[model samples]
Target: MMNRHQLPDTLLMGYAAGALPEAFNVVIATHVSLSDEARARLAAFEAVGGAVLDDDAAEMAEDSFDRMMARLDMLPQANARVTEAAEGIFPAPLADYVHRDGRSIRWRSIGAGVKQAILRTDGRASVRLLRIPAGQAVPDHGHRGTELTLVLQGAFFDGNKRYGRGDIEVANEETEHTPIAEAGEDCICLAATDAPLRFKSLIPRLAQPFFRI
Candidate 1:
């Protein structure tokens, strides 16, 4: 019900400007759906972008408003992408990529009661949904690049802090930790990483290439 972490303004601005990679975009879009603060910030960023564009453009024609409305109407709902509505555990934007029903998803077991479903993306980054059984701990790992993880259900705690539903944890090359899910319910996260993780465990290191985690 409450979020302790959210995307920074720079990242939200990148999302508003459509400058983020598709994998990251999915995480933002899904997070925005769950966060009112993020939604408001995104709207503010979009408004600034719109104002900038308007100031640079030539004088508006008399029918510009109508024309724009018509264009928007002609576009697909997904293309407009103004907001992500809650559908199931997956928000509207994420639902477009995979089945809302968890049972239908093709999840691959990673290890230690952890499973993942990799989502197809443009390859600028990798996107995956991670499901960790309650009380299970993911192996200790360090990031080689940026990692964005948005909790969709339940919660997880690194040694330092806990991230619950609607909270997004941003980690970079300098970060390293082991995340364990809270008791009672499984933790589901939408995660995007620009580079492969550096697992400390020998077994996970050997399996990294095969799982692409």
Candidate 2:
């Protein structure tokens, strides 16, 4: 089986509430494809979210409930059946639209010690996999829009907070964070970056044409 990690509660909560962006949803879907156990946990969280929504029924807008129910009823059952059939096969293809070249990930180096590959480009932001070697730092960068990252393997410290497997970190224009992979193994993460990263180096500026990060 492929190495899998459980998601942090915060991310699970955001996913359950449907607050996560669409691009990030593709990464979550890939992780779901890899780990049934994690999917089951997220399912439970969704159930709890449903229960809470029910409990707050009185506060919900009248049309909001009807709209939600309408949308639910409108969903095609065929898609659910197809997904179930696909899950039975499990983890072989990496993901529906991702490029895979064997067990070890194929990475395109973007900066010093930072390598990435687009798992799936959904016409919006590319759903990407990133690896940073221990003690390696990325270009001290910020985002033009929201960025969502889910740690898959190893760990990294960003702005004093340590993120491990399954921890989803959200960054936007308001925040600036520089991450260095923790010592031991390479830090591998799945992220959906909505906008181009703003780099702070001349090397990154020159290399930007060759490497799209």
Candidate 3:
């Protein structure tokens, strides 16, 4: 169970309404796959949307109901089976993107015992996977826009709080901190950002263009 933090209600509603960008959608879907609480919340938001539609007074064509039923019949079931990753490391939605077990990830070293793999996503946002060695610290940085980081394995502490598996850190322009991985195991996180990060150190700022962190 997730204990650190939950996705913001605005994001949950956007996900339920299918209004989020592909990058945000991917992160939310993967998080929901890992957290029963998130899944239940998403269901509640969808239920609210359905109720709103039911109360709408718009007139419909004579065959609209039949067409809707036919479309529903053609749609794939919501509970359709997804191929599970080994040991359940990657959630089903994420597994579909990586198409491999976590250990088999093609990691590119980003220096300081950290590795990353960028994921292709639509729109202006960027998505990536970060693997930080035990006790290693990410460079101090602030956000230009918003960043959503979901812990897939192990844990990390960002001075103010500790985030473990299934937990999400919602960082925005107002936040700045260095995240250090907890000892004992590597910390793996899925992150999405809408703009370039604001690095405090000169080294990180200079390397930002090349690393795209």
Error of 2 at 122 (Å): 1.6
What TM-scores do the predictions have? 0.84, 0.62, 0.83
- Tell me how far the alpha carbon of residue 10 in candidate 3 is from the true structure, in angstroms, after superposition: 1.0
Candidate 2 residue pairs in backbone clash: none
Off by more than 4 A, model 3: 1-3, 57-87, 100-104
lDDT by residue (64-110, candidate 3, tens digit) is: 99999889968876765555543566787787667534445678887
Extract clashing residue pairs from model 3. Answer: none
lDDT of 2 by residue, 7-59 (tens): 56666677778877666677666566556776898899899988987785355
Q: If both were scored by lDDT, which would come out higher, candidate 1 or candidate 2? A: 1
Q: Where does candidate 2 have its weakest 10-residue lDDT segment?
A: 84-93
Candidate 3 TM-score over all chains jointly? 0.83
Arrange candidates by TM-score, highest first: which order? 1, 3, 2
Candidate 1 to native Cα RMSD, angstroms:
4.8
Q: Per-model C-alpha lDDT, please?
A: 0.88, 0.69, 0.85
The candidate 3 region of ten consecutive residues with least summed lDDT is 79-88
